[model samples]
Target: MGIGDVSKRVLLGRKLRSSQLGETLLPKRIALPVFASDALSSVAYAPDEIFIMLAVAGASAYAWSWKIGLLVALVMLTVVASYRQTVHAYPSGGGDYEVATVNLGRNAGITVGSALLVDYVLTVAVSISSASQYAAGAIPALVGHEATAAVVAVALLAAVNLRGVRESGTFFAVPTYLFMLAILGMCGYGVMRLLAGDLPEAESADLVIEPAAGWEGPLGQVALFFLLARAFSSGCAALTGVEAISNGVPAFRKPKSTNAATTLLLLGLIAISMMMSVIVLAKQMSIRYVDPHELDRLRTAGGDALPEGYEQHPVISQIAAGVFDHFPPGFYFVVTVTGVILVLAANTAFNGFPVLGSILAQDGLAPRSLGSRGDRLAYSNGIVFLAVLSMLLIWIFDAETTKLIQLYIVGVFVSFNLSQLGMIRHWTRHLRTERDPAARRKMVRSRAINTFGLTLTAVVLAVVLLTKFIAGAWITIIAMLVFFLVMRAIGKHYEEVELELAADEQDKVMPTRVHAIVLTSKLHKPTLRALAFAKATRPNVLEAVYVDIDSRATNQMLREWDERRLDVPLKVLHSPYREVVRPIVDYALEIRRANPRGVVAVFIPEYVVGRWWEQLLHNQTALRLKGRLLFAPGVMVTSVPYQLESSQAARDRRRRDDHRVKAGDLRRGRVVRDDDQNQVGR
Candidate 1:
């Protein structure tokens, strides 16, 4: 095999056949980490966002941390329940986009699709950027290189996912579960210490928070409400990945919808527990964390600003330090696992975005390329697209979580609100026809749940728009609108092409006569073979056509053809500017112009080179000629390949690859028998 093939196999493991797709189906254990990592990993930073927002008003606003956490958890649970209903109702894996399109009409579906697409991009950017920050906190070397670290992390995640869903999930499952255990263990230990009245204070417990250029006294009710709304919107970042499960129900194993719903419920319960527990612990331990760039807002207990070069850790890091103070290993374990999960959280987007992209492609709203399966049966194009766009965003924002977070949840909530509204309409239409008592009762329950979810998510959407638009949410809205318009244009293009290509009565009619033209440069084996193949077709008119770029070469070719007593007439088209492709294209069009009801067939000799660079030296004129003739009306262009000696190397490489071990081959009991070798030999 070639060096490139070996490198790819080493990176991605092995090629998986189409039949092995069933083996890639995820079970609950793996699927939980694969699809739920985003929502679960948010606990690492969701509490930090809450604390950072409230820190604007100093510790006085800290009292509302638990309140915001609880409210966010409520919204999360509502979303989970609503998506459970969605998965059960629509298990085709289209998720919210499908629901909206089928129930609310095309525009609503397009809106939801565009919103989710933008949110998926933001998910990767925000998750990897946050992970880089956590890495910087734990390792001093990564402080100023967060953007570089984030881009590298995104590339690695894309490679892992390119291997396929089940494989990548298995690789990430350990870190996700470890993160859950570490936080839950820390929270449990911290609570035990609190009960024993021996819990140590956080590192920043003594530091005082100063309001950011605001009043030092009590605020009016309107100001208080605005502050709460801002904090709540920031805390709702935890809900960013809740809808991924609905989009990925087809990835589950047996009982796809049921497994998906169960996974969603478990995700909600675990995420809510971890989020609220961390907030409670941070408050109890008096963990102090502000926006990293706004460190001037913090003062020492002596009421003076801290000295320069003093770094502030994340809320979880500080809480971990305090909770596991006596055990340094436990502290490092928590920190390490937190960083790993933050990176793995982007896997949720990797899984969902590709699936959604495939569905959009199938619906003609996206490029048809996104619908193709790779060697691993994954939507690799979509994965790579998301990775590149995410790296661009990370670089643009310099991997600052605070900067990217403002653009984080607005798209998600826009999708959330519209999805729930669509679900409400879906059930209402179903209730009009569904008659069984038990089924009707279940549908009614689901409708009521979605209705409630719509109300809650709508309020959150408004809050997010109001509080974050100026903070950068407008970028996300603009991105969504651009995606919507682009997809609409793509759909229109596909429709027009389909209608133009549709066969009718005129398509089946036979042409009046066939005129075959052989393109020749010299009387070599390739040219002779092309002439013989063209004559074999027995066309009404046959001729050897040459572009006379040089008069001496054209005269020599004419002398050889006349001396050989070739039966076919030889025609030379003169190009004053020495253009090869356009002259031949014009000649063929002139032939078709003479007989309007006839077709002209043009056959050109092409070299089949094994190596890429060799191809650059040959077939330059023939390639351009074929491209031009393809656009000519009533002309059929064909390439008669002349395989060079070097092509044997490519054939040998293909033979080797066919015998290589493939993914799931052993599990499927596929042994490479003698017949496989004989087939390659043949």
Candidate 2:
């Protein structure tokens, strides 16, 4: 094969037949990491965000960290329970978009789709950006180049995901599991130490935090309420990926809905555990975390500023250090896995976005190209599109996790609130006709759960807008609106095109006559071949036409035509401006104008070359001529290819490549033995 093909094969492995799609279905073991990584990995930074928001009021506000964590966890649990009903109701993988569209209306569905699409892109950006920060801490060389490093990490993750869902999941499953183990193990050990009354304090435990300007004294109830609301809004980022499982139920194996529900439950419980543990441990260990940019707020006990260049570690990292103080290896393992899992967390978005994109495409709301699977049975276009948009975001935000975090969770919650509302409507609509009392009772229960979810999420969404709209969430809202408008325009265009392309009775009418013209520059083999092919069609009129840019060459060609004594007539059009394509185009258009009810067929000979550079050397005039003729009414343009000698090499290379044995070819009985080939030749 060619170099490009070989490289792709090496990168993505062998292509699989469409029938092998069932083989790619993931079991519960693999599906857990594939879809839950984003929610699980949020524990790494969710607590940090909680502390950053609380730090505005200084360390005194840190006492509320555990309370906010529980609040976020409670929202997550309700969301998970709500989506369990969603998967059972809509197992087709449309997730929120499908639910909203089918229950609410077209506009509602499009809103959910747009919201999810924006959120998925932000997921990749936020996850990879966070990972880059961790990498910068571990490797000092990456401190100033986190954006560049993040872009590269996004590209690598996209490449791995392009190799098909099952394969990418298998690759990422290990790190995701390791992260879970490391965090849980660390939390368990830290709690044990606390029970034994021997838990060491965090490295920054002694540092005193000074309240920001205007907060020098005790705060009123109003100020305290606002502060806690903002902190809770920020902490709610833990709920961002809870809906991914509903969006990806089709990727699961047998009993897809059940497996997906189980996975969602597992994700919610584990995420809540890890998140609550980190917060409680941070509080117990007196982890003095603050906004990385505002580290100056932290003061030494003697009322001295922290030394310049004193880096503040993340909440989890500080807790890991204090819990594993006696064993450096434990600290390193926890830190390493945390960083790796953050990067892999974007895989959840990579899987969800493309499937949702495909669904939109199938519904004519997105470009049709996004619906087609690549050679590896993955939605390659959607993956690449997500990667590019995320890289742009990373570059624009300079890969600062704190800055990007402000734009996070807005879209997901938009989808979450709409999805829960739609689910409530879904059960209500179905209960009207579901006759069986047992089934009715179950539907009523599901409706109640969804109703409760809707209430909680609706409140969260309002709080998010109130607290974060000025903090960067406005950008996400604007993005969702743009996506909605664009998809609506696409759907309208597809509908119009469908109507315009529908066949009618007039389409069956034949042309009155066929007027054929073979474009010729010289009396050579290619020109002669075109003329012969045109005559064989038995048109009502046939002739050879030439554009005479030079009189000397025109006369020489005329002399050759006369010498050959050809039967077909040759007509020459003189061009004073030395333009070749315009004259041919004008002549064809004139003919078309003269015969509105007839057809004008223009055959042009084009050279086919194998080498890429050879293409630039030929076919410039013919290409332009054909392009111009295509727009003329009642005119048909055809290219009669004359293959150059170099083209044989391309054909031979393709033949050889087609015969080569690929992985699984022998097992599938696609390989031809040497003896069998010899017998066929004999």
lDDT of 2: 0.92
TM-score of 1: 0.95
Off by over 4 Å in 1: 649-682
Choose the strongest candidate by TM-score: 2
Candidate 1 lDDT over 507-536, as tens digits, reads: 889999999999988888998899889988
Per-candidate count of clashing residue pairs (backbone under 3 Å): 0, 0
* Local lDDT at 550 for model 1: 94
TM-score of every model versus the real structure: 0.95, 0.97
C-alpha lDDT (0 to 100) for residue 656 of candidate 1: 80
The whole-model lDDT of each prediction reads 0.91, 0.92
Model 2: per-residue Cα lDDT at residue 241: 85
**Model 2 per-residue lDDT at 642:** 94
Which candidate wins on lDDT?
2
List CA RMSD, all candidates. Answer: 2.7, 2.0
For 5-93, candidate 2 gives per-residue lDDT tens digits of: 88998998888899988888999999999999999999988898899889889899998999999899889999999999999999999
